[model samples]
Target chain A: MTTFFSVAYYTFIENIRKKIFYGLILFGGVMMGASVLLSVLGGQQTLRILLDLGSSAIEFFALLGVGFSAVTLILEEMESKTIYLILTRPVSRFHYLTGRYAGLLMALYAGMLAMALMHVSLLLFNGWVFHARYVLSLFLSAEKILVVGSVALFFSLFSSSAVSSLSFTVFFWILGHFSGEINYLGTQIPSLAGKLAIGIFYYVIPNMQYFNLRDFWDVPQVMGNWVWLSFAYGCAYSAVFILLTVMLFKRKEF
Target chain B: MLRLLVISVVLFSVVNAELARGFAYPLAFSAADAAASYTGLDIASVVMGVRKLGADIAWIQLLQYYGTPEKPLDEDRAFQLSWDMTKYLFGAKIDKEVCFTAGCDDKSHYHPQIDGGVYPLFLQYCYRIVALDPSYYFTYLYGGGALAWNLNRPQEALLLLEHGIAVLAKYQHASVRDIHEPYWQLNLYVSAIVYRKSGDFTGMLSLLETAVGQPDAPNMIKGILANIYQKQKKYTEALRLWINIYDTNDLSYRRRAEEKVNELKKIICINPDFSIA
Candidate 1:
């Protein structure tokens, strides 16, 4: 457990030190600040505009950070041949992979939290009354990042190059959000082969709508059980990809 | 690798099935509708999962469109007059504006005198906005109110409000009396418009009064009610409502409210028992 945590800590520290991570966070802050100016355009809906744009900025930038770090963290080590030094130690490959993922999450979550704090302060400054849904939305956004990061990590191992992996990850991200549309199309199309292909894609892709609690923040039907179910789905889906990533890592020559 | 893949697939399938049964994803707008009203930013909003932000952008565009003064129909008039002379001389055919009406009260800001007060594609803009984010209740209220009151097209307003009601039906609570209930509020707006259409000024005033009394009633609605009160010579009531609107600090109504408040104060000072005869 200590070794696991140590690896996670090391990965977190290394990832946070990257210039891209800092740049993304800075950009996120600027975007959140810009939301205040944008809110004026909304007239009477100023508060709603601020809330929507601010939270979106945080989630978007955090997702970018997660995608970048997930593809690069282990691949960079492999390319530099620095992974051997860790593998030669007493640590197992599974621990290394899981620990690195955990660290990536930690770093990204920390950045998200910072942006969220800035958002909350801005909201409060503008007299936004507190709501538990804000916290729920932020938490669900983190879960979404977890699932996407895991998918990216798996692609990093499965694909031949970092560029292809990043591309595939982004493709999946887009597909994931449209999972409902894809499923609906599956039912609409008459061709048997097209239906079969869409059905496979539907089940294979992570359904990001599950973790899109922000979109449903004002929805009255989304009760506590639904939240828990979505949370479990995020964890389960991410675990599936993490397991696949571990399997691929175990087979590598290094 | 085969075992791992099987495990991953099985795990994903199990959780996915459970989630699918427990939670329903919100339905997106139909592709046909989205394409019909597709602005460049709207396509990005749909793909990027920022529908609310996109709705905000569309709302701003809608405001800008409405804020700019409508172009005069001078060219259309010239063409019509020339067409009449041509018909008198040579019997030439000319198309006339089908929806034109005469004697429209140009003095009223809310009443659109030409083309039945319908701005070109105003309803389409409202439809596009609601399609992007149905939960944006303000779009429904603002667009519906403008259509019914300013455009003098109560039918279009009712249509918009009904769409809002249908889309937001799931959000309705068991108690319909709640002021914060978006469904109930929309119904109130619909009823007020219906009363106005039927020429029941008293009924319309009562409904507007009830609506503006709600804690969450928009300042725009309050401004409307205050205007009605002033017209009816209920200076004290109008003054009180204007003060309330002024306190809300809405940019659209604040200056007007301040002017009305001061004007009403002087009227009351001249006659302490001021009332419409």
Candidate 2:
């Protein structure tokens, strides 16, 4: 456990030192400004447009942080053979993958926090009424991104660094949003075999619509069946895929 | 056993974070606007190069641009747009002169269209959002609704819905959005209603006729068509549809159908040649 924490802590420190982290945080702040610019284009939906832009900016930047920075941090170490040094010394494969995932999440958390603070401040300054639910929803939003990171990590084992990172990103985004379409297709194709195939595809993809609280930004959130359940489901799903990643690493040679 | 428990604990702890976050957000300090309001979608924004999701970026910006406090209502378009940054950050109400101006009548703040070529641009922005991500069905509904109802431009809404139906048919001709659609119907229902709103009731009737002919048209669509007939004073045709509604298990529909039937019977007794509708 200490080994895991130490690895995660150091990896976070190393990632924090990267210039891209600062660039991402800075871009999040710029999005707040962009919201003000955008709010003007909106007539009655001014406040909404502002917050939506802020929220989307956070999600977009965090996604980039994971794909461009987090995945690269892990894959590059392995690609450049730096993992061999740590693996030979005393660190196990499980520790390496888990620690890296934990560290990247911590770093991503910092980014999410900074951007969220900026976003909330802009909303407050604008006198916009917000429910405490934004926090729960935002946390879930971060979790969704982390799951994407886990997928990226799993892909890192089998593919090149760039390919792994980019593939997970495209997959995470499309599958998350398009689960609705998959459901639509499920009913369209009448063939029994086709229906079964579509059903499997739908279950295999992440249903991001659950965490899509943006459409309900102003609506108060209850720990209702959908909200808390979606959060729990995300964690369980991420854990399984990440465990699969660990399993893949377990069998890999130097 | 311990290792499995440890993993479960860790994952479970992540779930707890949501509970903790719900309690802490209100304590956060409010922040002022960090930067000045940018003018139009200037060269800077345009040239920045959308390394990804260009249409989405443009779509969001378009939303913000329309929602801004000093919506472009001023007689002098360029001058009104030049409202100082302080005016925005300070949260000043729109200038009286701007509101009184011809293009700026937004008393309710739901100005879907202000003159100065802004409102009409709703369709254009919808075009951009759709072009960027063609599978986004809701945008079509939104763009269709705004144009048909708010802007009084059902023609544009019809065209947009036409495109939406074509695109959606490719992926979701059949769907499970129960309240939104029933099976393969209502994809074209949106466009049909827009026809009705634009005073093309004949066009609306014809579209519904086509929908009625379809083997899978939902009952809701059928009821709506029947109601339109009642409004148009087609008593006999409406009576037959009302009987269908009365036969159904829906109490509310049944009650309304019975009342409508009784009223239509009296009208039919007076006018034998009631083809005026």
Candidate 3:
């Protein structure tokens, strides 16, 4: 446990040092500003424009940061033979991988925090500030990020670079956004191939859309039950993905 | 790809056919003629149709908001089309993949929120679309701001404008936000229009004063003061405003100003005292 904490702590620092965190601020910041133009061209749906842009940008940039970092960190350590050195120490491979994953997860959390600040700032600027629910949305967003991070790490067990791992991770992101529709469409399509694709994709993908309570948060119209249900689903999905990542890493050759 | 294209085309045609069949035949020719004379056929007809659809959607959304509606109504077809368009605006990347056409962009500018839905409900829907495509400005600007304002919902309009501005601020940064700063200015103008329609000239003037200085304010707005002055038979002051508009602005509203100038001339023609230096 101590060794895991040490690896996680260092990994968090290393990931933070990269340009990814800055990119998060820059991308999210830019999107918030662009909402003004959206309001203009939007004709009369400005609030919708601002809220949508602010929340969406936060989700996209955070996902990208997590996916890229998870894949790159694991691959780089392996490529540099750093994992071999760590393995020779008293630390077990599970502890090392767990620590690294934990660190990446923390970095993902930091990226989300940076994004949440941007969202809050944008909200304040727009003069539609909400506190309690906004913070909940941020927590949900962070969980969504973890799902992506875990997927990226799982792919990294065999991936050689962040790009390849991200490619797979991107699929998960797409799946997360479209999971509901996929399930809906699965029922409509009669073909075995179509049903199989939809069914398999439904289970395999992260289904991030389930956690997307941005609409609910912005409107604050949804009941507490739905919010709780979404949180439950997100937590369950995150745990499953983390377990999958650990399993893949355990079998990976050093 | 070919199969998908064929399927989409078929679906599109079927949907249009159904819609066409549902239209009131002979089109209430008397009422249609009166409306056409004032607003022109295309704009008039489309607005009336859209307004009706919006009204239905609004009622449904209102019901949904109050928890009165137990089931989604068929009126949601229009809402869903707008929803899909909003989805596309956000980089869903499904526009090309789908066989049927639906979604918002430069072309399909109607925002469901602006049309007729309950304010909060529509806000949630619009937020989803904007989230997907923060760059698509029309959803927030025209849909939320202008339409809602015209519909006599200023509070909702303010909310929409604020959100839209924030999104643009984030993506485009302060510089681009400045470029589109006229939009924020226009919101004030719309407020003036709203007040003017409500017979609150004092409030209108106050809003217009703020609006005219905005980077994007049209010259016509400045001329509006002159027109208002002319209404009061304050021809000389009106003339000065008309001249200011004529001297400073470009051609965008030249014709409208020309008509206003002619109107001012008629006022002076009736009373020699109306002439200004």
Interface RMSD of 2: 15.6
Estimate how well candidate 3 is docked, as a DockQ score: 0.01
Give every collision pair in model 1: none
Q: lDDT per residue, candidate 1, B201-221, as tens digits?
A: 899899889988876677767
**Each model's TM-score?**
0.86, 0.55, 0.50
Better of 2 and 3 by DockQ: 2
Q: C-alpha displacement of B207 in model 2, angstroms? A: 34
How large a fraction of the reference contact set does each model reproduce?
0.42, 0.05, 0.00
| The candidate that achieves the highest DockQ relative to the unseen native structure | 1
Every candidate's lDDT: 0.79, 0.62, 0.56
The TM-score obtained by model 1 is: 0.86
Model 2 regions lying over 4 Å from their true place: A219-223, B1-277
Tens digit per residue, CA lDDT, model 3, B1-277: 2354355445434433342233211111222123112223223222222222222223223223432222444777656654554454443433332221123344434332332334445555444334433333444543343334334566665565676565444434324323345445545645765686678989987776676555334454565566667677788677656666654433323333444566677767766454322
Ranking of candidates on TM-score, top first: 1, 2, 3
Which CAPRI tier for candidate 1? acceptable
